[model samples]
Target: MNLFHFSDEGSIDVFLPRVKENRKELPPVVWAIDEEHEFTFFFPRSCPRIVYTRSDEMSDEDRRAFFGATQANIVVTVETGWYERIKRSTVYRYRMPAETFELFDTIAGYYISPRTIVPLAVEPYGNLIDRLIARGVEVRFTPNLHPLREAILNSTLTDFGIHKFDNAARA
Candidate 1:
């Protein structure tokens, strides 16, 4: 399977292993996502968002409550303020050879390499929001993600990611 790294900047030539400020408990490593879950990064970095999908453990009641009749298996939600930025944003997808990376988070599709690496190629994706919708992702915009976050955390929507949520608007 192909692996990729997405960034707002496009001039990256080398990816060095570095610990993220927010995730100090983990060792320094270069992060990449597999092609199947690339949709997870289809937004401006630091955009406080939540993405989730139906999991085998999820009850039918929860599935119907969260995904009504939507055909999209994946659902992503961001605060209302990020809407305009999402519409105008452009992200660069850096393709990486998966040989040097090891599976880090299986459910998240994350792979990590302890050593530095070079991207095979970089491709630009503009009209970020449009691209996400085109890929069959149900996109949502809410004024405050606090309630949703609490709901998902308390519920069975376990196959999910809440990225940069510390930056989300307070309730």
Candidate 2:
């Protein structure tokens, strides 16, 4: 299957192994689709809070506290089969249909971040190319990044936000 990941130019080539040192907890690998709901959820600052689960299922205050007010979240789609084969203890996996996935635009991919992810290549989502360019984010076509380029291209979605990976000390 073809999956997509949205990232800025700096950390596009690297995969994080764990959450930054400052944080007390670690986050699973995360990715999202380009649909409106997913885009809005991932780009928290772009729209109002989107509650995926029933409002009664979890308090609004709890949800907001769990998911920050605004975050530069990266949206990526992983090839389930490939990801499973190389799964590790630190990573956890969660899957949902497009509708459900888009609602919250969040997933727990692994218990721990992958130690290293040297992206095969990086490309810009066509729909968000103009905005990315405006933000001075390098938007280029990395055809050789993955074998499923065509499929990923077709699945590309709208813009959310840009995440810049800091390669300095973890903390």
List the RMSD of every prediction in angstroms. 1.1, 17.5
lDDT string, candidate 2, 80-128, tens digits: 3222222221211122222222222333211222334444444433333
Error of 1 at 99 (Å): 0.4
C-alpha lDDT values of all predictions: 0.91, 0.30
- State the lDDT of candidate 1 residue by residue for 139-168, as single tens digits: 989999998899889888879889999899
Q: Give per-residue lDDT, candidate 1, residue 10.
A: 95
- After superposing candidate 1 on the true structure, give the runs of residues whose Cα lies further than 4 Å from its correct spot: none
Q: State the TM-score for model 2.
A: 0.28
Pick the TM-score winner. Answer: 1
